[model samples]
Target: MNNVKSLNKWANAHTYLPVDVLRMALGVFLFMKGVYFVSNIQYLVDLISPIEKIGGGMFLLHYIAPAHLVGGILIFFGLLTRWAIIAQLPILICAIIINFMGFMHHQNLLLALLSLGVCVFFLIYGSGKNSADYFFKMEQ
Candidate 1:
């Protein structure tokens, strides 16, 4: 009986529940940020001008919003998480590139870089514990 109780306690300690919660939170946050950009189409449009003169256009902003929205949803729900992270990587990289190329200085570019770094962390580590990946692996 003592051994059984100890094993139960150990299992509880090793559970990945926290990781799943964190992953969902991050995904929801990113998703909402992206949705906000989409909802405020004008902001993206205005950004197009400055970026377009540097060879980018409104289309880029238009595309990014959807990617954020979709990626966020996927990551949040642990559905196709790997694919979602991979998809968003390009969008994040483009934001960094566009910011650097179009800005007068590097402040915005730095911000973009930071944002990209965060995304990269998620992409690499994933929602490790308690995530769909974890459950999926265990089931297999």
Candidate 2:
């Protein structure tokens, strides 16, 4: 759409090296989280257990880790950065909601909130100059 094109244009003009670094850091964090979930399946199970009563919880159990893994990689390389962030949005939102519904860990709540905020920022900011998306765009 026109809006997206305009936003991309704006992001490219505004982007700098530090923003690109932040995006990479975010990607690493999410990827590690995916690895954590995959390694400790039981922890992930317990994470969603309280919300099981909300329905569709089992689906989340299966969905979160893989989404994080794939989405994290896509985001790290800045390949389809917005799309990757869009995919991550639901998981991050659920993470925040889940924290409130259960035994509250301030650390987790804060981390989730911070990560969600950054994700939202990057969603608008795009990948910046030093990214696969920019490089690929140049090639085309």
Candidate 3:
């Protein structure tokens, strides 16, 4: 916990505008993906259909869109960013697995990997100085 606090302090001190913008872009991408998933529910269902025998596949199905939606908003606003990204990580991991289960869609795999990478980055770097998390902490 002490190490985590020190890392966070270092990350916050080193943040830059470009990094914040990157975070915003990642958030937007996730939000748009959520919207896409919501609009094309059938596609997502079909994608995960093969995994239905796994017991909790359907349950996981219900989590994806909402996680992306809520998590994206939280990440975009830089509020509880690590928590939001943590929520997204599992979904992204499943996405990667699903992409390979049936058909190897290189594009989808690439996108998932990229998103996962960004999420991992934010998970460590935090919301930075321009984030709502920082703002609220400062107020307190």
Candidate 4:
């Protein structure tokens, strides 16, 4: 379809090596952060308590770790990168909200803001030429 061609063109257009490097870096950062969350379950639980009070509950708390883990891996490999980023958005947004509410440390707010910015960038530009998305798209 013409639309698919258009999308592929747009996705491949104007990609730079730096962008891909940054994307991979973001992926690593997210993956490590996710691992941190899993390793520090008590800390994660405590951090999400306020969010839990805001109707997120135990379910939200419990799922956040694995979502980050899986999403990070997907992003890292550039496999289904957009979907991975989309999946992480809800948790990231919620974190931003919670952090801004003065319930978290100032440094946490900064980290959340930075993470949100990078995620938004990748969401819009996708994975670039160095990614699995690019390889698959090329094969198509």
Candidate 5:
């Protein structure tokens, strides 16, 4: 009985609620963004503009959207947290560079950039406490 109690205490000693909140928030945001992109097909089409400049086109956009759609759901669930963050980084970076960098003059770009910035921060730091990464690292 004493050994069981000690093991339980050791397992939970490092658990933190704030980390879990952060992770959940990040996941929710990513999922929402994915849904928004899916609903706004034109927006995703515009996303391909950068690639278009390099000779790519709608084919790439179609492929990328499905990935984002799935990735968003993965992020929301805290499943494969690190990989989800990594997958979203490119899209976020492109948004920051293209929209936030003054490519367009309006509120839309600003909002997109702000959202992208949050995602970037989460990606760099992580989803927080209640995440696979956190517990996995604990085991290590």
Candidate 6:
């Protein structure tokens, strides 16, 4: 059918520059967050100490900081963009969960939501045409 053909065409279409820009913005934000966590590791450890008391919570906290740093760097350069987004997804979801649990400050809720949105967007659309992933012709 014509509709099906049109849909296929749309699906295969290259994304515009805005998508890349948004991806870069998210990458920078996540990178900075990682840097902040690393620089203030003691503070992060202290803040999460209570949650770490729960089973498996300490394991999650231990890996999240480094994951953020590595994922952010990969995303910023558009290298392995989809995989980077996938790697970051769990952290973003955990942030949403924490926020909903009233563990986050009211002002931080909006930031968490926004970051989640960006992560979801990149997860779905990928790095677009401007990324190293695309340049290297890696399949999305």
- Give the candidate number with the greatest lDDT: 3
Task: Give me the runs in candidate 6 sitting further than 4 Å from their true place.
Answer: 1-12, 138-140
Q: Is candidate 2 or 3 superior in lDDT?
A: 3
lDDT of 6: 0.74
Compose the digit string of candidate 2's lDDT tens values, residues 61-106.
Answer: 7899988998889888899989999989999898899898998878
- CA lDDT, candidate 1, residue 5: 45
TM-score of 4: 0.88
Off by over 4 Å in 2: none
Give a tens-digit lDDT track for model 5, residues 5-93. Answer: 45435534654776556567666666776677779989877755655776656666665566567776666565665577677777766
Per-candidate TM equals 0.67, 0.96, 0.95, 0.88, 0.63, 0.80
Ranking by TM-score: 2, 3, 4, 6, 1, 5
- Tens digit of per-residue lDDT, candidate 6, span 11-55: 338678777788888888888888888898886675455456566
- TM value for model 1: 0.67
Clashing pairs in 5: 19-129, 23-127
Considering only N, C-alpha and C atoms within 3 Å, which residue pairs clash in candidate 1? none
Q: Give Cα-based local distance difference scores for all models.
A: 0.69, 0.89, 0.90, 0.80, 0.63, 0.74
Instruction: Highest TM-score: give the candidate number.
Output: 2
Tell me how candidate 2 scores on lDDT: 0.89
As a whole number from 0 to 100, the lDDT of residue 137 in candidate 5 is 59
Model 5, poorest ten-residue lDDT window? 4-13
The digit string of per-residue lDDT tens for model 3 on 1-140 reads 88768877998889999999999998999999899989999988887875778888767778999899999999999998999999999889988988878788899899999999999998989989999999998899
Model 6 — TM-score against the truth?
0.80
Query: For model 6, what is the error of residue 3's alpha carbon versus the real structure, in angstroms, after optimal superposition?
Result: 18
Off by over 4 Å in 1: 1-22, 53-61, 104-111
**Model 5 regions more than 4 Å off:** 1-15, 100-102, 105-129, 132-140
Candidate 1 structure quality by residue, lDDT tens digits, 1-140: 57634543454356577656766876886788788887888876754555567655655876778888898888887776767888888776766666656654476567557667766666555555456655675698
